[model samples]
Target chain A: MALTLDQRSASRRESRRPAGPRPVRGGQSPLARRQRRIFGPFLAIPLALYLVLFIGPTLYSIYAAFTNWDGINTPTWRGTDNFTALFDDPLFIESFWNTLLILVVVGIGIFVLAFSFMLLLRDMKGKGFVRGVIFLPHIVSPIVLAIFWGFLLRHDGLLNALIVKFGGEPVAWIGPDSAFLMIMIAMVWISTGFYVAILMAGVDRIPGYFYEDASLAGASAWQKLRHITLPLSWDVIGVAAVLWTISSVKVFEFIYAFGASQGQMPPAYEWNAAVFVYGVTFGGATPQYRFGYACASALVMLLLVTGMVALLRRAMRRDAVQF
Target chain B: MTRTGRLRRSISFAALGLSALLAVSACGSPSGPGDSAASGEFTYWSMWQEKEPQAQVIKAAIDSFTKDTGIKVDVQWHGREVMKKLTPSLRTKAAADLVDQSMNQLGNGLSNTGQSADLTSVYNLEVPGEGKKVSDVIPSKYVDYLKDKEGKPFMVPYEVTGEGLWFNAKQLPTEQPQTWDDLVKLLDAAKAKGVSPLALDADNTGVAKYWPLLTLIRAVGPEGMQKLASDRTGAAWDDPNVLDAVTRVEKLVKGGYFAPGYNSGQYPAQQNLWAQNKAAYILQGSWVTSETKTYAAQGFEYSSVQLPPINGGTDAVGVNFFGFGIPKTAANGEAAGKFIAYFLNKSRLEGISTKADNITPRADIPAPAALESLSKSFQEKAVYPSGAALGLKFGGWESTAFQPVAQSLVQGKTSAADFVSQVKAKSIEFWKTQG
Candidate 1:
C-alpha cells in the first residue's frame, strides 16, 4: 500500500517537475533509518527512566493523597477528605500564602533587579567580570548561601556586629515581623543573577543595529527597551516567570536551614509549601509521618503551579517579533 | 524496505524492551541479609553517628556483648534520621532487629504503627555480669512512662533528658526558686544587675514552646496539659489555668526580661548568649551544657532548676528518654533483648554519664555534674514525658497549633487574651485536619 502511494506521489511530482530532489520512498531513507537506529536507544533509556522515576511516583502520590496512610500502614481510602481539610488547616493556608508571596513578590524583585543589571551591563566595561561576579550566588550551593545569609542577618551576626562597631544600636534584622521579609530579600538576591544571565542571553541575540537605529531616531533608553529589547526577550521573560513560579513553591532548604533552630522546623509563619510538606511528614524532632496529608498538600501545590503556569503562558502569548 | 532498515527497527525494539526491563527491576525493593535468627546475629540501627561520644560508648558495650555471648551482631550507625528511615524498612525484611531513638521518636515511628515489639520481657531480662535486671536499674516511673497506650513497654531507657531553666552557676543564684513570683523577683534582680533574665531561640518553633509549656505544666498539671493538647474543639485553651500561664509569660515579656532579639535569632545564638553570661537563664534540654561547651564563658559553670511550683498545681517534671526498641518483625528478638539488658549494666551505662556527658537511666551512676540537679529531679519528683508525646500522635498539633501561638505570646506580639484565642482557633483548625 505504501509503495502504491509513493508511486502516485512520484508520478504527481513528475507531472509538476518542479522539485530539485526526489522524496525518499515511503518517507524512510537509509540515513533516516540509521539515525533512528542510533538515537532510538538514547531517547528510550531516559524516557524509560523518567517514566519510572518521575511519573510512576507522581501517580502513586496522587493516589496516596486520597487515602489515610502514615507511611507505615495500609492506606485507607478517604476520598476528598484530605483536600477538604487543607483549606481549614491554618499551617497549610499560611504556607500556601507564603509560597504565593515568594512567587509574585520575590519574582518581581528578581526581575526588576535583573533587568536593570542587564541594561547597565550592556554598555559597561569589564561586563564579563561583573556578570561573573553577579552569577556567583547562583552557582554557590543554596545551603551555603543560606548560612551566609544567616550570618549576615542574625541578631549578633556580622551585620549587627559592624553596626555596633561603628557606634550604632544593633538592628533586629530577623525579628518576627521581618523574618519572612528578609527571607524574600535573600531569595531575590540569590535568584536575580540567574535571571540576569537569561535576560542578557535573550537581549544579546537582538542585533545591535536595532538599538543604533532607535538611537538615531532619538529614542530614549526606556523607549529603546520598550520597543526592541523587551519585545525581543518576551519569550525568555515568560519562561523565566514560569521557572520562578515553580521554583518558588519548592524553596525549602534555604528557609529551612537558615530559619530552623536546633534541627527543628522554623516557625509556621516562615513555612512555604515545601517546608509545610516536610514539616508534616519527615522533617522535625518528632516526624509527623502524615504521608497522605503531605501528599495531598503536595498535590495542591502542583495543581496551583500548573494553573499559574497556564495563566502565565496565556498572558505572555503574543505575536512573535521577527527580528 | 531494505535489510538495514528492518535490522535497525528490530534493534530499536530490542533496546526499548531492554531499557523498560532495567527500569522495572530498579523499582523493586532491595533484599537484605537472610534470617538473623538462624545466623544467631541481630541487625541494630543506632541513632548516633559512629564518631559521636554516645556512639563510642554504645560501640564498646556492643563489642563486649558480642564477646560475652559469642553471638555476632551487625550494627549500622544510621545517625539522627534512624527513626525516619526505619519506617519504610519496617514493612520489609530489611528492618533491623534492634533500633534506638528517643521515646518520643519511638512513639511516633514505632508504637503508633504497631511495629514495636513488647519490651516487658526485655525489662525483666537479667543484665549480663550484673546481679540485677533491667527494671531494677531503671526506676519504675520511667518504665511506666515508656509504656505504650496498650500498657506494654516498647522501649528500654539508657539515657535520660530533662527540660528546665539552664543557667550559669557562676552568674545566677544556685538556690532554686520556690515560687513563680519568687522566680520573677530573682529575674528582676538579675536584670537590675545588668544580665538579661532569659534567653530564647524564638526562631525554633519547637523550643519556643518551652516557656509556655513549662508555665502551663506548672499552672495546670501534665494531665491538664495533655487535655489541652488533645482537645479537638479547642475549648481547653479557655481553662483559666492556661490563661494564667499565658499571662505569666506575657509579664515576663513585658518586663523586658528576655535577652535583646531573643524572639528573633536562631537557636544556639540565644542559648550561646546564656552560655556567655550575657543572659542569666535559658530553658533547654539537659544537653545544653555539652552543646554550648565550646563557646561558653571563660569560667562558665552549667546548672539547671525545675520550673518553680504554682499553688494548687502538680510538680511533675518533663522528661524524655533515649532508649532502644525492637521491631515487631525482628528475627532475633531474644538476642536483641539480651543486648538491652547487657548495655544497661551499671559499668557499661556509666559511659553515658561520664563520657557522653548525659544522664543515664541507672540513677546509681553519678550524672554529669551539670545534669546532677536535673537527674535528682528526674528520680525524686513526679515526672512525665514532655508534651505527653502528643505532638506526634495528634498530627503534629504542637508544631502546627501550639508553637506559633506560643511564639507570638512569648515574643510579646500577642496579648494574653489574643494568645489564648489564637491558640484555641489554631487548635480547632489543627484537629479539623486530623479527621
Candidate 2:
C-alpha cells in the first residue's frame, strides 16, 4: 500500500481544505424541536423558584429596614429612624466592632495558619492523616465544640483542674474580656484546616516539572513559593478569603452556645451582628420582634461584606498563568 | 410512537404537573389550626423539656384533662427556652391553644404586647369538682402578679416562685446575718475556710443580678425600687436607699465574695459548684431543687433565708407565681381556659409541690418538706413582687439597664455613683423607645 510522494501530497492538500457544512441534521427533526421547547420550561421552573424564595425575601428585607414592623402588627414607615437608633445604641456599636474584629483579625489569623500549613504539608510525611485530624472540627457540630471549649475554660473545668494540680491559680479564661478572644481563637482553629485542605488541593495541581525546572534554575523554597506557588494558587486563595468573610460574619452557634446556660440570649457584651439580629427578632426572654431594626442592621452587614468581597476580587485578580 | 399517543402522554404529564402545583399551593396557604368551638380537641405547648420532672407532672395533669373532657390533646414539650419559639408561633397559624410559661416571663412575652387573651374569666371559673372558685384557693399575691397593663388578669397563676439566698445547711453558719455588715463578716469567715462566700454566675445576668436587685428591694421598699426604676429625673437613683443597695452589690463584687472567675463562669456550673458545697451560698429561685437534683451532693439539704431588711426598709422577698397563658390566637381558647382551671385544682396543684418540688400558687397546698423552711418563713417575710408584675413603665429594664451595669459594678469597671448615672441615662433612652 505504499503511495507515491505526489499522491500523498495530493491527499494532504485535499484534507487541509475546509469542508462545506453538511445538510442541516435531518432539517431539524421534530423530536429535536420538541426538546428545545421543553428545555425552556424546565429552566424557567428553577429560575422562578429562585426568584420567589431568595430574591423576593431579600427585596422585602430592604423594604422592611425602613419600617417599624413588630412581627405581629402592621409595619409603620419610619424612614432612617431604625438606622439612627441602631447607631446610637452602644450594644449595636459593640456588636458591629466585634464582627469587624472577627472578620479582619480572625481572617488574617486563619489565612496565615492555613497558608503555612499548606506549605509545610506540601512536602511532609503522613500529610493525609494530619489533614484529616485537623479538619475533624469542621465536620463536628459547632455546638459540640463550643461545649467542650466552655468546659475547658470554666473555673473548675479541666484546664483549671490541671492548673490547680500543679499549684497554680485558676485563670478566668471565659471572663468578659477573654470570652470573645477565646471565641476568635476557636474559630481560627476550626476554620484553618478546611482552608488548608483547599489550598493544598490548589498547590497539588501544578505540574511537577515546573518545580523541577525551578529547582534546576537554583530556586530557593521561598522563591519557588513566591514566583510559582503563589501565582498558580491565587484563584483558590481568593475564593477561600471570600468564603471566610461570609462565614465569619455569620458565626452564631459557637458564641451562642457559650451562653446556653445563661438563658436564651447571651450577655449583650458578647453579642455580634448575627446574635444581635436574632436577639432583636426571636431571641432573649422576650422576643422584641424588631424585624425592621434587625433588617437595617442586617443590610449594613450585607453591604459591608459585599463591598469587601468586591475589593478582594479586584486585589486578587491576575492574568491566568497557563502551565 | 404515534403522534396521537405522544399528544395523550404529554397531556397526562401536564395534568399531573398542574395537580401537584395545586396541592402544593394549597398546603402553603395558612389555614390557622381551626379553633374548637365545642372543644373536641386542642393543643398545648408546655415549656418544659421532655425529661424534666416538671414536664412529667404537667403531662399527668394534661392527661387527666383529656380523660375528663374526652378531647384529644397534643402537647409539644418546648422546655424553658420556649419564649423564643412561643412568641413567634403566637402570630402564626400553628399557634398552640395553651402555653405554660413563667409569670415573670409575662413582662417580656406576647402577654406584654397584648397578644395573649384575658383569662380573667378563667380566674373566676370554678375548679372542676372543687367547691371553690380559682381566686378562693390561690393567694391574692400570686393573682396580683397576673395583672395586665390595664389591671385585667391576662394569665393564670399556678407554680409559685421566690428568689432568696440558698445555702447548704451543713456548710454555712446556723444563725442568719442580721445586717449587711454582718453578712460581709460571715463572707469573710467563709473565705477564711478556703471556701468562696458565694457561687455566682454573672454571665447569667437574669438570675444572678437579682442578688443586687433583691437587696435594693430590701433597702428601698418595693415602692422605692419602682420609683427609681420609673423615675426619669435621675434623682431617684441618688436616693440614699438606692445608693445603699448599689453599695451592697459593689461590696460583694469588690470583696471577692463570689468564686474566682465567677463573672466569666457559666450558670449551672456555679450553681452545681454550690450544690457540691464548694461555696457558702447561691442566689437562686425555688426551682433550684429540681434543677440540681442530678448533681445533688449526698445529705445536702437546701435552705434559704430572705435578705435581711437594710436601713429599716421593708423586709420583702421576691415572690411571683409561674403559670400558663392562653394566647389570643389559641385554636381552643375556651378549652385552654378550662384546662388552666382544672390544672390549678387543690388536688392537681399539690402535685406541683409534691412531684415537681415547686411552690404551688394555691395557699391551701403546702410546699414539700424540702422547701417547708422557706415556705414557713415566707409567711413572716414581706413579699416584694417584681416591678414588671406591678405594671412598671418598661419591659426588660432590669435585663437591659440594671444587669449589664451591675456586671460592670461587680467587675470594678464602674463605681456605685457611675452605675446610677449610666442606668439613668439608659432609662431615658429606653423610655424614648417605649412608645
> Best-fitting candidate, measured by TM-score?
1
Candidate 1 chain A minimal-lDDT segment of 10 residues:
A1-10
How much is B107 displaced in model 2, in angstroms?
A: 4.6
Interface RMSD measured for model 1: 3.8
- Top candidate (lDDT): 1
TM-score, candidate 2, is 0.88
lDDT of 2: 0.77
Q: Model 2, DockQ value?
A: 0.24
How many clashes (backbone N, Cα, C below 3 Å) per candidate? Answer: 0, 0
Q: Which lDDT tens digits does candidate 2 get at residues B1-435?
A: 544676789899889999998885454233222233556777888888888878888788889888998877888998876766666666544367778776756555656666677777777778998978888877666667567778777677677777767887776765667887888887798899999898877777566557767787778888787777777665677777787788888878877788877776777788888888888888777767678878979988888877778998876666766787777666677777778888877777788788888887666788886677677665666665653333223444554566677667766667887887898887677555544
TM per candidate comes to: 0.90, 0.88
lDDT digits (tens) for residues A95-127 of candidate 2? 999999899999999999998888888889999
Off by over 4 Å in 2: A1-28, A262-264, B1-36, B81-83, B86-89, B92-94, B104-107, B171-178, B192-194, B230-233, B377-382, B387-393, B429-435
Off by over 4 Å in 1: A1-44, B1-38
